[model samples]
Structure formats: C-alpha cells, structure tokens
Target: MKPIVTLTINPTIDLATAVAEVTPEHKLRCDAERRDPGGGGLNVARVIRELGGESLALYPRGGSTGELLERLLEEKRLRRWPISISGHTRENFTVTERKSGREFRFVMPGPTLTEAEWKTVLDSLSTVAADVEFIVASGSLAPGVPVDFYARVAHIAREQNAKLVLDTSGEPLRAALEEGVFFAKPNRKEFRDMMGPQVDEPAGMAAAARSFLEKGRAEILVVSMGADGAMLTTREGQYRAVPPPVKTASSVGAGDSFVGGMTFGLARGLPPHEAFRWGIASGTAALMSQGTDLCSRQDVEHLLTQVQPTRLA
Candidate 1:
C-alpha cells in the first residue's frame, strides 16, 4: 500500500502531567508526567500507525525542542520529512486529574518561519507529492506563513493527482475552501465560526454546508458534534453516523483520529457513509483513551461494530 502523507505546518511537543487539582494562586504538585510528539497531522499519523497503516509525517522543526520532538518520533519509528528552521519549537501542556476526570490544556504559539524557510518547505513538498497516495494537511499556520498555505497545498495535491484531506479552523479553513479541497473535517464550533452568524441553527449549518458543496469547494464536509455524533454531507447525499454511547475518558485527539480513520477508509475506496462509520468509531475510541494516546486498532474495531449510519433526507 502506498503511504499516506501528512503535512503539519505547525507542530508541537505535547507535555502532559497529572495534578490533584487546578487551584487559583497556588502551586499544586501531581504525578505521571509524559511528553509526546503532537500537532494535527502528526496526531493523524500516530493514529494511522496505531491502526496498522503506514504514513509519512512532514513538518517544520527548530532548536532544542524540535530535537526532542524528533527523538520522540524516532522512538515511535515513524517516518518523517523535517524542514529545518531557526527558532525553537513550541510545547503544549495538558493537565489531567485522576479522581476528577478533568483535563486542562495550555497551548503556546509555535516558531515563526522566515520566507526562505517557508519556500524550502513548499519545495520539499513538491518532491514528496510524487510518491504519496494522499496529502493530509492539518493544524494551524505558524507566524510568517500565509493563511492560504493549505490552499496552495491543495493545488499541489491536485497537480499530483493525490487526494487531500484538510482539518483546520477559521480563516485558513475558509481559504482552503475557496481554493477547493477533497475533504474537510470541521467540528461543530469550527463550522459555526467559518459560517459566522449564519450557522445559528442545525438547519442553517446544513444549509451552509450545502452551499459549500454546491460551489464544489469540498467533495465532502464532515461536521463533528461531540456526543451528538457527526453530520456528513457530500454531493451524492447527506448522512449521520452515531456511535454506541460510551463514557468518554478524554476528548483530546479524537477529531484528529476521526480524520485519520476517514482518510484510511477513503484510501481503501470505501463509500462516504462507510468512511463516516470508521471516522465516528475512531473518534469515539480515541475518547475512550487517556491523555493523547489516541485510538488503538482494537478500540477502533470494537467501536466500528457498534457504529450506525443513518441517511438523511
């Protein structure tokens, strides 16, 4: 099988620790500190690897933190295309409480790239495109990068005849949509943010999605609604996939897992609805794990059996 290629313009070192509680004006001590390589596309790659799929992760790296991130990926034995930069990479912190089932996340801004660095990364992608089956561009754009970076990648994917799956938010997502994409995975709030005040109701959300479809901006639009499940809209039809209710352990990385699962299914030529089942199952399965561990093959397989897709009129 050809490898799935994931591009992450902004990547980070995810440091998670346990704390008794998050108290105001106090330093609380905890246990079980863990650090992992993260970022949207990287998380998707992690999920793919866990599911017995092969993927190549590409992203910019810089300084000592970047070195740490690379070492972590090396430990996982994941293939990578690292674009060297000058500034240090960023770290995101997640604090989890064992007794309370609460998690707090602190995200920081990643390194800013120079024009030369940006151009180098794009040039590297052109070379990578020739061998990749799918180009998955996910996550935020770092400073010094244009909002349309993903849009440019979409064009490159088209030129290479490779499918593109985009998972992002706000203006970058809007820009990608304007340039057209193969698929977009947006959570409920992100969809609302992109559509502005227009997506006030469920019907409005559907309408906004239909408008995007009508314009051919995206071949498929998946809106993830957490516990409410997900809504999938495509040119062929619309459908909803709901998973069997399970108590969520932590919501982190669920959406990325969903994108990974959906891309995996689509890469295998599965229909939209069937792909959606895999997506929802992967998402729910990720929610069943702690911290940023994401979904395991067994978790996804068990959840797949309990997922049901309903056609919408």
Candidate 2:
C-alpha cells in the first residue's frame, strides 16, 4: 500500500499547562508546561503512526515557532516535508484547571502567507501526491490564504487519482465539496453550519449527507458528535457508532484521531462501514488520554472490540 499524505496549512506549537483555577487579573502559578506539534493534519498523521501505519506530513514552517515544531516532530520520528515561509508559525495555549479538570484553549489565527508562499504549498502537493493513495487536507486556512485552497487541493488529488480525505469547516469545506472528495469528517457544529441548522436531527443530517453524495460532492461523510460518538453516511446506507463511556481528559485531538483511524483502515482495504468502526474506537481512545497525547494503540485495539455500530433506517 502507498503511504498516506497529510497536509496542514496552519500548524502550531501547542503549549499546555495546569493551574488551580482561571480568574481575570489574578496571578496564578502553572504546572510544568508541555509542548507538542499540533494541527488537524499533524495530529491525524501522529495518530496514524500510533496505529502502526506510515504517513508523510506536509506543512509550512516559519520563524522560531516553526523551528520548534520541526524539532518536536523529529522527536516523535514522524516523516515530514516542510515548506519555508516568511511569516511566523502560530502557538496555541491550553490551560487545565486542576480543581475542575476543565480545559481552556486559546487559539491564535496563524500567520498570513504571501501568494507565492501559498502557491508553493500547492506546487509541493502536485509534485509529491502522484504515488500516494490518500491525501488528507485538514485544518484551517491561514491568513492571506484563499478560501478555495482546499478546493484546489481536491483538484490536485483527483488529478493524481488519490482519495482526498478532507477535514475543515466553513467556506473552505464548502468549496472543496464543490470539487468533490473521497471522504469528509466534520464535527456537529461544523456540520450544522455547512448543512444549515434545520438538519440538526439524525434523519435530517443523513438526508443532507446523501444529497451531497448524490451530487458527487463526496462519497462518505462522518460527523463527530464528541462523546456521543460519530455518524457515518455513505451512498449504500447510514450507520451510527456510539463509543463506550470513558472519562474524557481532554477533547482536543479526538476528531483528528477519528480521521486517522478511519483513513488507515481504508488504506488497508477495509470496507467503509468497518473503517467507520475504527474511527469510533480511535476517537474514544483519544478521550482517555491527557493533553495532546492522542490515542494509544493498545487503547484503540481495546476499544475496537467494544464498538458495535448499528445501521440507521
């Protein structure tokens, strides 16, 4: 099987710490900080690696934070190809309240990429995507990047005969769907925004997803419902997999882990329904981990046995 390729337009150095509580204008000491390479696609790639699969990650690098991101990936021994940009990479801060175990995330809009810089990313994809079986374009468009960027990525994937596994939201996601893709994963909030609030119920959401499939916009759609598990919609039918309960440490990377597991199963030639189970298992496993630790292979394997998906009428 060919290696999976993942692209993250706006990568970040994730900084996490714990404090007794969060209050305005009060100086509070924090626990030792933990830094990790973060971004939707990067997290997916990391999860794939954890599941014993191979993937090549592509992302832009800039400034000192970019350098740190590279070193972090190296420590994890993830294969990567970095493109240089003039703007500084962004850093996201996560604070966990020790008393309540609640997490507060502070996200920054990533650096603005110049036209040339953004085009360089497209050019790189065109060059390396030919032999890959799947190309995952996840995360947000950075400042100065066009909304149609993922649409363009879909075009490239189609040209290369690769399955495009896309995860994003808003205009970029809508634009990409216009170009069509092999699979898409959106959280419930993002799904509501894309398909309208009227499609909030399961039946309505299924109809909306099938409509897109009929139009050739996408072959499969999965909506991550956080602790409620996920819903998978394909042309053949619809299914829902609710994960077994686990105490959620943090919900940060659950979506990415789901994508990674499902994509990995697909690459291994598993049918869509069976692969959907892998996604549910991996996502549930993520809830069991702390910070950005993501899902462990043991946990995923254990959860896989517990997941029993039911067909939706």
Candidate 3:
C-alpha cells in the first residue's frame, strides 16, 4: 500500500460545548469545553490516525487562530504540511442543547486565498502525488479560491496514477465530478443538489448514483443518508449498510470518519463491499463520541462486527 495524502483548503479549529439552551440577547452559560483540530480533511486525517493509518495533512494557515490550529494538530502528532497564508485561519463553534439534544453549529468562512497561495498547494501535490496511493481532498473551498481547485487536483492525481476521493459540495463538488474521480461521498442533501430534488428517495438515489458511475463521473459513489444509513454504488455492484441505532453524542466528524475508513480499507486492498462496510462502521463509531471527539478504533472494530450489508445490484 502507498501513502495517503489529504488536502484541506479551508480547515478550522473546532470549539464545542453543551449549553442549557440558546437564546439570542442572553448570556448562555456553557458546560466544559473541548477543542479539536477540524475541517473536512483534518477530521478525516484524525479518523485515519485513530484507525491505525498514517496520512499527510496539507493546508494553509496564518495568524493566531492558525497557530492554535497547528498546535492542536501537533498535540495529535499528525504529520502535516501547512502553507503560510495572508489571513488568519477560521474557527468554528458547535453548541449542543442539553435539553433537546440538538446541536447548533456556527461555521465561519475561512480566509481567502490568493492565486499565488493556492498554486502552492498544487505544486506540493505534484511533489507528493507520485508516492501516494490516495489523494483525498475533503472540505469546502476557501473564499477567493477557484471552484475548479479540486478539478485541477483531479488532473494531477490522474497524471500520477493516484486515486482521488472527494467529499465536498456545491460548485466545487460539481466541477470535480466532471473530471472523473476514483470515489466520491455525497450526503443525501448534496446528492439532491447535484442530481435534482427528486434524488432524495432511495430508489432515485440508486439510479442517480448508477448514472454517475456509468457516465464515468466516479468509479464508486457513496451516498450518506443520516439515520437511513449509507449506500455504495459501482460498476460491478451496489451495496447498502444500515448502522445499528446508538445514542449519538455529536455527528460532527462522522462523514470524515467514513471517508477515512473507506480510504484505509481500499489502501489495504480490501474488497470494495467490505470497504464500504468499514465506512459505515467508522461513521457509526463517530456518533458514539462527544463534541470534537471522532470515532475510535475500538468502536469502529466493534461496529464493524454488526454491519449487515445488502447488495442492491
């Protein structure tokens, strides 16, 4: 197996806690807090680390918040390469309502990236792509960055014969799909946004995903439906796995964890079906933790034993 590399263009430092209630124009006393290195790719890298896999995390950062983000990742001992930028890195906040079990997430738009700065990421990928097996680009694009950033990455991945796994949305996601990635993970909403409003139903989703595969947009596509579980589609077959209901602490990192599990499995040459189950397991495990705490290896292994995958094709 070759090395795994993850790129997060708009990563954040996540601060989370529980509050009795949230009301505007009132002082809301919060409970004990937790801080973690965050953003789509960072969370995926953390999940990969928890699963006993190693990955190189690449992102741009600056200012005090950026320093804090770097410190957080350092505490986790994740291998990282941070590109210095002009503006400060952003921080996101998650507040869980103790009474209703609802989580309120306030996401900040990350700093804008200039053409020169964004190009550094591409140059870095060019250097690492040759030795890597998978290049996973997850998370939202920063302001001022081209929506085609990931498409440029897709071309680089192809040049180096590396698989690209995407977990993003909106124009960026749509553009990358046009480039034909190795795999893609789109939640129910993102899938709907791409294929149309009718794609939310399971049958419609399967058809939409199959169409994507047939059109060469993606070799394998996974649609994550919260509560309804997840489904995987490929040229060879389609499979669905439902997670056993468990008390969810926070779903902050579940999607990233799922991506981590899928990459970990595929890198180890596991069968695609089995790898899909691993993704389901990792996602369920993530729900078992609180705040910024992601899935654990132990929980993922235990959850893996209970995954019942059904082939739909």
Top model number, TM-score: 2
Candidate 1, poorest ten consecutive residues by summed lDDT:
194-203
Model 2 CA deviation exceeding 4 Å by range: none
How well is each residue in 178-265 modelled by candidate 2, as lDDT tens digits? 9999999998999899878756887788888777678888898898898888888898898988998888888878989999999999
Which parts of model 3 have CA positions greater than 4 angstroms off? none
Off by over 4 Å in 1: none
Please write out the lDDT profile of model 3 over residues 1-313, one tens digit for every residue.
Answer: 5668999999998999899988899999999888889999998888888888888999999999999999999999999999999999999999999889999999999999999999998899888898888999999999989999999999999999999999999999999988889999999999899999668577888888898898999988999987788999988899998997788888888899999998899988988888998899999999999888989999999999999899998
Model 1 accuracy (lDDT, Cα) = 0.88
Candidate 1 clashes between residue pairs 3 or more apart in a chain or in different chains: none
Which ranking of candidates, highest TM-score first?
2, 3, 1
Query: Cα lDDT of all candidates, in order?
Result: 0.88, 0.92, 0.91
Ranking by lDDT: 2, 3, 1
lDDT-superior candidate, 1 or 3 = 3
Cα displacement (angstroms), candidate 3, residue 99, comes to 2.2
- Whichever of 2 and 3 has more lDDT, that candidate is 2
lDDT leader: 2
- Candidate 3's TM-score reads 0.98
Q: Candidate 1 on 186-292: residue-level lDDT in tens?
A: 99899888776676677777788898799988999999998888999998888887777887878899899999998888887799889899999998899888887
